[model samples]
Structures are given as structure tokens and as C-alpha cells.
Target: MKILFNKPYKSGNELKYIADSIESGKISGDGIYTKKCHDFLENKFGYNKALLTTSCTDALEMAAILIDVKPGDEVIMPSYTFVSTANAFVLRGAKLVFADSKKDHPGIDEEAIETLITSKTKAIVPVHYAGVACDMDKIMELAKNYDLFVIEDAAQAIDSYYLGKDGLKKPLGSIGHLAAFSFHETKNIISGEGGMLVVNDEKFLKRAEIIREKGTNRSAFFRGEIDKYGWVDVGSSFLPSDIIAAYLYAQLESLEFIQDRRKSIWNRYDNAFRGVLDSKHDITLPFIPSHATNNAHMYYLVCSSIDERKKLLAYLKSNGILAVFHYLSLHESKFFNGKHEGLNLKESDRYTNCLVRLPLFVELGEQEQDFIIKHINEFYKKK
Candidate 1:
């Protein structure tokens, strides 16, 4: 049987809700279904405000505008993150200052952030890689001292929490000044190609709406808080149709089921590989810090080197299972070669070369997973 790397799962109510949204006659954004999605996210995540967007890239762009990222302003972020994280700021003419990943994990190194901050530094974008929380307390402290804004790239971090110094657990998106979440098919919860921009700072609340609504006070006008909506600030057509929200609401309603199944699949991979492969120095499993919670976004392994990873990937494919590597270090990309100062982002490059993600979707059955596990173990055994 040919196994795919990722297959989007559908909750039973998705079509029914989408049909209901169509019948409502208001298929535009911010209609009943959109309101329900916003309410669900805001209430469930304790975010001050949440606005749905066409995609996570759009949400990040909205965030860049909200923070007033000016030309020549600098934003610090990990080199291992998705292009959307950097492109958002670049679109606003902000210079990207890339940071390295931690030695043990793919998340940004919190200790190295302070060293990168300059007078031009205006914001810090920390991506919660693999739905594992970053060192937020340290990140927040650094931001506070530097008077910088924090935008959580929570594209994979749905239903994840970070334990603060006070021993209280706060949601990942809620901790940042602003956060962007993805609902792409590969993510834990999907709305095809959807995203949400979460506003934690009350100051950006009004502007967030305006930016998502194509630079208008249209949201306030709808609430009768304004006489008529018109141009207000820099914005775009960031909002998604209510039909997308309706489909997302169905997934949100079944969040528990999805989470549980995904977690089980993640654990199954972990348990299958822990003693079998982790004993060798050439391979490493994921490391979860004490302060972070896992949301089972993806399961990846780090091989000894790029050559070994390529062989392993080929092996998986030959066995009718598909495994893939993740992001290339952004600093080394062709687009940033001359722009990015020559800095040794060793960990980011290592992840780019050696990490391989296995299939871990909600619909992946146990037998199929066991077949995957068997082939992986067989490959390693021969190696």
C-alpha cells in the first residue's frame, strides 16, 4: 500500500455546516459562520480578539502592518521557519535578522535573541516549531527589556500551552503581543487554506479588524458602532469567506477527537522508535522541554547527516511509504544569500538536511502505522 505523508481529515459536520452557510445568503466574510469561528477561537483560547483570514500568510502580513513595520526596521526570527514568517515583514520593507535554532530542537534559540537586537530592531517572531512551545518567558522578558513586539508564528501550535515562570499555563498564541495561526490541510485543524490573526494587545484590536477588512472600518459599521465604513489604514482583502469558517467550525467542534487521535499517532511513532533507534548516536528523537506542551503537530527524526537522510527517505519511498524533509535554513536560501550576513546557523542547516517527517495524520490506521514502523525499523536494522 502506498502511504502519503499527510492527508487532511474531515469532521462529520463539515459539509452540513458548509451547506448551512450557503443557505444563509451571506457567503461573504464576517457573516454568521465567520462570527462563530471568531467567537470559538477567542473564547476557547482566551485571546482578546481573533480574526479569520484567507491564509496564515495573510495573517502574518496583517500583523506586520499592525505593528507599523517601517522601511529599514529590523525583525529577528529563526532561520528554520517558513517563508511566510519572513515574507510578511519583507513586504512591509522590514529587514529580516535571522537567528539560529536550539541545538536540541528546531525552535529558535532564546539565548541568542538578545545578541541580535539593535536600535533598528522592532519585533521578534518566534515560531512554535512542531506545535512545541518556545521559551516564551525568556522571550517575553527580552522583548520587555528591549521594548520590542512579539508575534507568535503559531502556524502549527493549535491547542498548545506554555508554562510560565509563575507555574501557570497560558496558551501559546495568547502570550505573544500578536499571533498568527494556520488552518492549512497539513495542520492539526484545517479549513482548507485558512488562518487566524490573534490580538493580545488591546491597542491593536481596532486596527486589526481594519487591516483584515481591506483597510476599512467595515467591522465597526456592521456592529452599528460607525455610521459608514470607509478607508482607514493600510490593509488588504485578508478575510476568508464564511463558508471556510463554517467548515472550520465543524473541525473546532471536534477538536478533542482530532487532538486525541493525533496524539495517539504521535505516541505510537515515539514508542516504536524510542529504544529501537535513539540508542544510536547517529539518530535523535524530538526533545520536549519541561515548560512546553506538545500538540502532536508532526513527528520527525534527525539522522546523522544529509546523506543518511536522503538514503532513509529513498528507503521509505521504496517501501511504499512517503517521508519528507522540512524547511531549508532561510538564511542560506538564494533570496537571502547576499542580504543575510554570513552567520553560522548550524542547527537550522542541520534540521534542513537531516530531519525527516513521518506520516501522522488522524486517519492513518494502526496497521498502516505498524507497516510504516516495520519498514523504518527494517531499514535501520540493515543500516
Candidate 2:
């Protein structure tokens, strides 16, 4: 069998949508499809405003702008997250205060955040790793006590929901003052290369529009069909091309079915690996919290150490399964290494050294899953 992400889910009528956008002769940003995406997110997530961006990276950058992050300011986020989560603030001249991940999951430990917050701390960026919702309640409580702004890095949480204390499931991006999402090709859904910014606060909504449109009220001008628009604020061209928006709209329309199928594949892996996972102290299953819903973005196993993980990686490769690993713990990377391990980030490094992600694309088949599991079982049994 050929190596693939092993999950199977087509995003949308990508080519057709793009072609339609081209035929419409308005392939610029903020066209029909862009409005559709805005409406889709606003209605689905109860967002006060939704802006399509070139990428989640851009959405995050916009958040940095809206918060007016200044030089020497510090932004707190987990060590085990995609760089974009912190890079946005870093670009705005803010220092990244890398917090450790929770012992149970990749999400940042809320307890650790308080100790990191200081007079120089301007904002907190919480990443919801692997489409699993972070402890937003705890994070929010901390933010409230500190009087800080919460910008959720919801890059993997497009359709995922956070289970609130009231027993209701809230949209992932809707909880934070501002949140970002990805539409990369590898994600559950895609617009080729597009993303979104969902802002809950009306105060920043107007400024966000201008920043997304190169510091102009172009969005308003476009709506007014104005004869001219001038520089209105400090912004950039973060909006995605109209064709990109069209493709994303197609994916959004099929989100329900796409999410359902992805969940099934995730379940398959979870069920198949349960025995091998719990059968030993060395191999561990992904630890998801009770209140969080798995979006099936990935299925990863935790080994005992970095050496064991590397050996397993070699074994999986030799067996023709493209099982992979992730997140080098930005805390320890050559470019980002630091001396102060204040919170005893033993758990963060523990996560980096141990976690092994399995192949989990939407189009992955059952037979392939069985083959992958078979190799995994053999690796464990013989060891």
C-alpha cells in the first residue's frame, strides 16, 4: 500500500470554485465567496465579526495589531505549539514567554500561566493543539484576574467545540476575544491556502477590517461601492484572494459530513490501538480531557522517552507506515533556547521527547489502518 495520511476526506469542489471565481471576473479579495465565509463563521460560531485572511499566520498577526502589542511586551503561550502562535506577537516586538504544557495533554497548563504573567505581560496566546480544546475556562479566569486579553490560537479548532461548565458546548474560537484558524491543505478542511480571524469584541472589529485591508477602510468602501478609498489605519494585505475564498466556501458547505468522516477514522485508530496502548507502561495513548471534543485532527502515541520514540519511528518507516512525530518544544530549540526553566518544564520536554503521531488524513482507508495497526502491534509485542 502507498503511504498517505491514511485518512480520506475531499475538501470541496476546489477547481470548480476557483474557475467560477475566475469566470465572475472579480478575483480580488473580499468578493462573493469571502462574504460567504464571513457569514458561515459568524453564524456558526456566533462571532461578532469574521475576516478571511491569507493564512492563520495573518489572522494571528492581526490579533497582535488589535492588541497594540509593543516592543518589550511579553506574550505567554505554550512551548508545544506551532510557531505561528507565538511568532505573530514576536513580530510585533513582543517577547514570547514560553509556558509548559499540561501533564495530561499538549495544552498549556493554566496554573503555569499565572506565574508567567507580570507587569510586562500584555496578552496571553493559548493554543488548542491537535483540534482539542484547551481549558478555556481556566485560561479565561486567569486572564480576568490579570486583566489580560485572551487570543486563542484555534488553528486546529475549526469545527470543534469547548464543553462549558454549564454542560453546553461552545464554539472553540468564540470564547476568546480574538481567535485564529487554519485552512491549509493538510487540515481537516482547506481553501488551498486560506485562514480566518474571528473577533468577539465589537471594539476591535472596525480596526481589524482596516488592518486586514492595508490600513484602509476598503472593506467599507467595497461595501459602499465608493469611488475611492485612502489609508485609514496601519494594516496589511492579509485578505485571501477571491478564488481562495470560493474554494473555502465549498469546503465549509460540506463541513458537517467531512467532520463526521474524520471522527470515524479517529475512532478507528483509537479503538484499534487501545489494547496495545494500555497493555504496557511504555506505550501511551493520547490523553484528551473529558470536557474537550476530539476533532480527529491527528492520532498520536506517547512513548516513554525520546530514544524509544526515535526507534519506533525507524520501525514504522521500515514497515512502510509513515508514522511521524512533532513539536520540538520551542523552549529547547537552537533559536529559542532559554536559561530560565522557571516552572520546571520537565513535562514540556517530556511531551517533546515522547509523542509520536500516526498517519491520520481523512482519506485513509480501513485496510491501510489494519496494516498500520498490525505493524504497530508487532513492534510492541516483540519489544
Candidate 3:
């Protein structure tokens, strides 16, 4: 009866991995298993170079460092993302240009992005929330046309894909010049606390390596390749221990199963709540475009308005379901105000008010799902 995030976290072989790390005596960072995980991601996903980091926030900070963000440099992103999306650039003193979300979802609106660009605009951080692929084609088109750097915040987008003009589906993180991933316990996989940065461009790979190594040329040095690797540049200690990577590797080896299990749960929720799709035009389910194949990261409901959504939240929590809400609009957050004054992000505001995220994880059983659905349906009936 405890439908607590029934996720099958990294229990199997995690202790063994840690034990091995201890025996190896190289448990600090970037060991053999780190290389194995890095190789798996590169070969499996087509990323040119992948660097394991402490968290998605660390990877994002690495991207910000690579971009050399500074005061007056503007980084555009949606107002609906986790604060880490904007905080990464803000740490480097970059100006934030917040854009509205799309008419249908929380992903950034492409039309809105173009309008926000100016000479001071240096980068675009497109967060693919809920593992759903944002309109990458349109975003890429804008990047090329405007000569802007693209940093994809693929925190929830592991197996998700987008169909390009070639008609073949491209992996989510592989397409962007730079992408960040999260392997936090809350995700489909659990590494306890870890993340990665994927570098797509050949030119950026060298700099990325140095940044991950505390601003040194140590990566080359480790290869018996360099004479001396010193404090070569400005960087931070972003790498995670090989112990965490080993656990992540075990979880990744079962990626297909994890994805399949989560997908089944997502379908269950979608089917049980199917009738609510058209219950009222104002209250709708997630509308995914044909081109996007999400990783089943989250399943949420969009209600009629802010107040209606709030009432449902109270009802669900009161019933012990642990249902939660999503991000408050970042543009209106305490940190950044006044800078982007005329930036009225309407869809972001709507999502901030109406979106209610339900729990989704591997091992969410039929009874648990039924109870959740039962409560949800009951609330709608009384409403």
C-alpha cells in the first residue's frame, strides 16, 4: 500500500562495485569503470566525447566554463526549467533572458527564442523536460542561422529521440553541440548522485577534458602523452568517483529493461486516465508531437487552471499519494527580476500554475497504480 517512489534503484552489485573500488585503491575519480561507462555512452549514443561529473549541475557548470560566460553575456532558456539550468550560467555572471514555453508543453518556444537574441546573446540552454525531445530541428536551425552556441539540458532525456528530416530518429543528447545528463536517484536509473557531460564537437572535446580535470592538461598526461600537466586553466573538480560510475554501469546495462518497465507504467497511467483527455478542452493530458519519443521520465496532468490544479494537489496528497507540482517560473524567482522586464512568458506561467506531476518509477505495481488512479478519478468525479 506504500506507493512510495517504487523505483528499483541501484541495489544489485552496487556494494560489490564499491568494494572493487576500495580494493583497486583508485577510488578517487576517473578509474577503469569510469572509462567503461564513458565508452558505453560514446559508442551507444554516438556522442563524440563524454565526461562523467558529480551531478548534472556540475556538467552544466563545465559547459558554462567552456563558453566563458561573463557579465553582459546573455544565456536564453525557458522559465519553466529547474533553477540549475539558469544557475549554471548565472554562476559565471551571465545575464538571463527568459523565454516562454510552447503553447502545448514546457519546452522552450522556438519563435520566442529568436526574438530574445541580441549581440550580447551568447548561448541557448534548451532543457528537454520530462525526457520529451524539444523541437531540436527548429532549435538547431535557429542556432545555425544566428550563430549561437547550443547547450542542451538533457537531464531527463536519456533514451528519448527526435525524428530529423532524414526520417531516422536521432538520440536526444547526441544532436546538440553540448549536452548534460543526470543520473540522480530520482531518474530512471540511480547512481545515488552523479551526472555526465557530452561534447559533440571535436573542437570542444579538448577544452572539456581540461575543465573536468580541475583546469589541468592531466588527461593527456595520464595517457603517458604529456611532459607535464599543471594548473593550466581555470576549472573546478567536477569528476565523480569511479565507484559511482560502476553502479551507474550496472543500471545502464539494464537500460532497455528499465525503459520498458517505465514505459509500461506510463501507458498504464495514460490508459487509466484516457477518459480525462477530452473531459474538458481546458483540462488536457500531455500532447506529444509525433517526432518526439520520450524516455517515460514523468507523467503529469494539466488541469483547467491554477486553482483547479491546487485543489487536486491537496486531495491527492491528503490521500497519501505523494503527488507533487513542478517548477515556479524562474523569471519571477527571487534571484533574477527587473533584468528581463518585458519578457512575458505566458505558457510558462500556465504550466507553472496547472501542471501536476505524478510519481513514476520502475516496480510501480498494478495495485499501487490502481490506487493512485482510483483517487485521481474520485477527485475528478467530485469536482
Candidate 4:
């Protein structure tokens, strides 16, 4: 049996919605389907405003623009994240200040953020790695103290919650000043390639829409708030077509079903490996902090060494199961090494070399998962 790392699950209504969008005679950005998507996200997540973008990269770029990232401005974020996180700020000529991952989790180390802040710092980006929440309380406090903006890299954090000290649960994307979410085929909720930007601070609400529509007040014009719209600020055509939103809306309608199944699959992987791998001293399981809710975006394990990870991946591939590794540390990457201040990001490097992701999609059957689990156990036993 051949097993791929990821397979996009269809919610059964994607084509139907897409056809409806095509028949509507207006398949451009912010059409009827697009409005439905924006309403669904805002109402369900309690986000102040939600705008669908062509991709998460676009959403992040919009965020970079909203925060007014200028040359010489510093934006601190984890090194163990996708390049898009840093690239958004980099495109604005902002200096990237790389932070390390947590000792127990792949998410950013909240405790290490303050020291990275300086007079030149303009923003703090906290990535919710693998749908696990970062410590927002500490991060927010730090941002408040320093008067910095917080742009959440929540690409994998849809349907996840962060439990606060006040005993209230806040959605991950709604906590930060601005947040970006991805609907890449690999994620739990997919639209082939789509994303959304959540504007939590009202200050950026109007400007966010303008930036998304190529620096024009078109969104307002569509709402009858303006008679004419034209170039007003630096921006881009970041919004996705209504066709993309139509596909996304179908998935959103089945969000609960998708989330529940994914969580079950995640639990199966966790239970299969937990105590069973206790003897494997070099392996570390996924860790979810008490304050974070699991969205089961993906299941991953961390090997103690790069050699072990490489061997494990090869073994899985040989077994016809295509498990994969993730992310190289950005601070040491060829493009950013010269810009880095030579700080030791050991945890980031550790995750870079050791992390391996397993297959955990909604459609992965019990039999297939059992086969994968059995093979993994067999391989570790022989080690």
C-alpha cells in the first residue's frame, strides 16, 4: 500500500459551489461567495474582521503593510517556521530577528521574546506551529509593554483555542493585532490554495481592506460608502477570487466534522507511540501545553539526531509510507545567515534536524493508520 504525506479531503460541496460561483456571472474577488466566507469566519471565530486572501503569504504581506514595517525596523519571530513568515517582513525591508523554539514544543519560546525587542522593533510574530498555540498571555504583555504590534502566524491554527488565565478561551487568530491563516491542501481545512487575514484591532480595519484591493477603497465603494475609489496607499491585489471562497465555504460548513476526525486520527497516533516508545530515548513526542487546544493539523515526532531522523524517514519510504521532515532553521539559511547576529538558536536547530511528520488527514482510514503504526513500532524495536 502506498501512503502519501498528505491528501486533500473534499467536503462533497466544493464543485457544486464552484459551479454556482461560475454561473453567478461575477467570479471576481469579494463576490457573493466571498462575502459568505468572510461572514462565516467573522461570526464563527468572533474575529473583528476577516478577509480572504489569495494565500497566507498574501495575508502576511498585508499584515506587514498594515503594521507599517519600514527599512531598519525589526520584527521578531521563530526561526523554526515556514519562510513566508519572515519573507513578509523581509519584503518590506524590515530586519528579521529570529527567535528559538520552545524546549518541549516546536512553537515559539515566549520567554525569549522580550530580550529580542529593541527601540527598532516594530512587531512580534508568534507562529502557532502545527496548530498548537503559543503563550499569548506573555507575548501580549510583552507587546503591550513595548508598544509593538503582534501579527500571529496562525497558518495551521484554525479551529484552535488558547485558554487564558481569566478562564475564557480565545480563538488563536483573534488574540493578535492581526493574524494569518492558510487553507493549503495539506491543512485540515483546505481550499486548494487560499488564506484569510483576521483584523482584530479596529485601527487597521479600513486600511486592511484597501491594501487587499490594490490600495483602493473599493471594498467601501462596493458597500456604498464611497462614490469612487482610487489609489490611496501602498498595496497589492491580495484578495482571492469568489471561486476560491466558494470552495472554502464548503469546507467551512463541515469544519466541525473535519476537525473531529482529524483529532481522532491525531489521538490514535499519539496513543500508538506514547508509552510504546518510552524505551527509545532519542525520540520525543508532540507536546501540547495545558493552555493550548489541539486542532490536529499534523502529527510529528522529534528524533534526537539528524541521523536518526534520516534513517527513520528512509525506512518509512521503503515501507511505502511517505513520512517527511519539516523546516530548516531560517537564522542559518544562506539568504539570512549574513544578516543574523550570530545568536545560538539551539532549540530551533534541534527541531530543524530532528522533526518528522506523519500522515494524519481526515480520510486516512483506521486500517491504513494501523499498518503505518505497526511498521513504525517494528522499526523502533529493531533500533
TM-score of each: 0.99, 0.96, 0.97, 0.99
Full-model lDDT for every candidate: 0.94, 0.85, 0.86, 0.93
Q: Choose 3 or 4, whichever is better by TM-score.
A: 4
Candidate 1 structure quality by residue, lDDT tens digits, 1-383: 99999999998999999999999999999888999998998889899989899999999999999999999999999999999999999999999999999989999999999999999999999999999999999999999999999999999999999998999999989999999999999999999999999999999999998888889999899899989889988788998999999999999999999999999999999998897698964688998999999999999999999998999999999989999999999999999878887479999999999999999899999999999999888888888
What lDDT tens digits, residue by residue, belong to model 4 across residues 1-383?
99888989999999999999999999999988999998999999999999999999999999999999999999999999999999999999999999999989988899888889999999999999999999999999999999999999999999999999989999999999999999999988989999999999999999999999999989888899989889998899998999999999999999999999999999999998897675456688998899999999989989879998899899999999999999999999999868899479999999999999999888899999998999888888888
**Candidate 1 lDDT (Cα, whole model)?**
0.94
The list of candidate 3 runs beyond 4 A from truth reads 5-8
Residue pairs clashing, model 4: none
Give the lDDT ranking, best first.
1, 4, 3, 2
Candidate number achieving the greatest lDDT relative to the actual structure: 1
What ranges in model 4 sit over 4 Å off?
Answer: none
lDDT of 3 at 97: 89
